[model samples]
Every structure is written in C-alpha cells, then in structure tokens.
Target: MKQLRVKVTNAVGLHARPAAVFVGEAGRFASQIRVRNATRNTPWVDAKSILSVLTLGVEPQHEIEIMADGPDDTRAAEALQQLIASDFAGKI
Candidate 1:
C-alpha cells in the first residue's frame, strides 16, 4: 500500500463538487484508494465513492491520510496527493 498525508485546501472541504472530483480521480486508478480525516479521528472511507468520501466530513485545514493499495498504488497515491495539494485545480 502507498500512503500520503495531505491537507485539505478547498474552501468547502470535501463536500459536493470537491468530493465528486476526488471520487472521479480515484476511479481512474486500478488500485483501491481510501481516505480519512486524520485531524478529526474518523474512519477511512473509499475514495472512489462520493457518499463514502462525503461521510469523512473533511474541512479546510483538516489533515487527511490517503492510502492506495493494489497495482498502481503509488501512482494513485501521488495523483490524489497532487490533487489535494493543488486545491483540486482551483475547483475548490
């Protein structure tokens, strides 16, 4: 498994559109991606599922842990790291 620690930079956190974007990005990879609000003490959720991601209740300034397992895990982890670090390409 590959993992990354990223801060949520989106103004609204991982709600709605941002969550949708995240789920979309996660779907591109063959690996299984999961995310948890590290700053909050929440259970990890499947990054590829919008409902699961939204349940994370991630907010701006929240630190998150992302884990990717299976083939392409490294690439998947990096992609999500970059996405969050980029503020979801200003989509936030």
Candidate 2:
C-alpha cells in the first residue's frame, strides 16, 4: 500500500463537486484507493466511488489520509495528493 496526506484547502472542502472530481481521478488507476480523516477510526470512502467520497464529510483545513493498493498505487497516491494540494486548481 502507498499513502499520502492531503489537506482540504477549498472553502467548501470536499463538497459534491470536488469530491466528484477526486472520484473521477481515482478511477483512472487500477489501484484500490481510500480516504479517511486522521482523527477517524475508519476510512471515509472507496476513493473510486463518488458517492463514497461525498460521504467523507471533509471540511476546510481537515487533513485526510489517502491509501492505495495495486500496480498503480504510487501514481494514484500522487494524483490524489496533487488534487488536494492544488485545491482542484487547474482541473476545476
């Protein structure tokens, strides 16, 4: 498994649109991905699933841990981290 820590920088955090964006990116890889708050006991979602991502309840400034498994884990981890860091900058 590979992991990355990303902070939600958007005012609305990972709301519907941003979460959907994240879910879309995650689907490009074959890796299994998940996101969870550092303070949480369980993961928020299956990163590839938009519905699961929206359920994360992430808020501004919240840090989330991203994890992935499979051949594309590294690339997926990088993509996920970049998404949060850039605040969906260019993509959105």
Candidate 3:
C-alpha cells in the first residue's frame, strides 16, 4: 500500500466539478484507492465514487490523505496527491 497527505488549495474545495475531476482521475488507475479528510478526521471512502468523495466534506485548506493498494499503488497515491496539491491544474 502507498499513502500520501496533501492540503486542498482550490477555492471551492472538493465539490461538484472538482469532486467529479477527482473521481475521474482516481478511476484512471488500476489500484484500489481510498481517501479521507484528515482535517475532519473522516473515514476513508472509495476514491472512484463521486458521492463518496463529495461526502468527505473536504474544504479549502483542509488536509486529505490518500491510499492505494495494488500493482500501481505508488503511482496512484502520488498522482492523487499531485492532483490536490496542484489544485487539479489541467485536470479541472
């Protein structure tokens, strides 16, 4: 398993479009990915599910942790960390 923690800097946080972008990115990987709102101390949720991620209640400046376990776990974790760190960048 691989894991990373990153702070969300996007204005709207992970909601609506951003959440969709996040779930889309997560769906690209073959590994099983999960995410949790570290700042909120929330339970981990399926990263590939829009509703699961939206329910995280992530907000601007909130920290989130991502984990993945599989053949591509490392890449999966890093990619997600970068997605949030870069505020979704070209993805959104």
- The TM-score, computed over Cα atoms with residue i paired to residue i, of candidate 3 is 0.97
lDDT by residue (38-90, candidate 3, tens digit) is: 99999999999999999999999999999999999999999889988998986
Q: What TM-score goes with each of the models?
A: 0.95, 0.90, 0.97
Sorting all predicted structures by lDDT, with the top scorer first, yields 3, 1, 2
Q: Residue 62's C-alpha lDDT in candidate 1? A: 98
Off by over 4 Å in 2: 39-44
Residue pairs clashing in model 1 are none
lDDT of 2 by residue, 24-73 (tens): 99999999998887645456579988777777778888889999999999
Clashes per candidate (backbone, < 3 Å): 0, 0, 0
Better of 1 and 3 by lDDT: 3
Instruction: After the best TM-score superposition of candidate 2, give how far the Cα of residue 54 lies from its true spot, in angstroms.
Output: 1.5
RMSD of 1: 1.0
- Say which candidate scores most in lDDT: 3
Better of 1 and 3 by TM-score: 3
lDDT of 2 at 84: 89
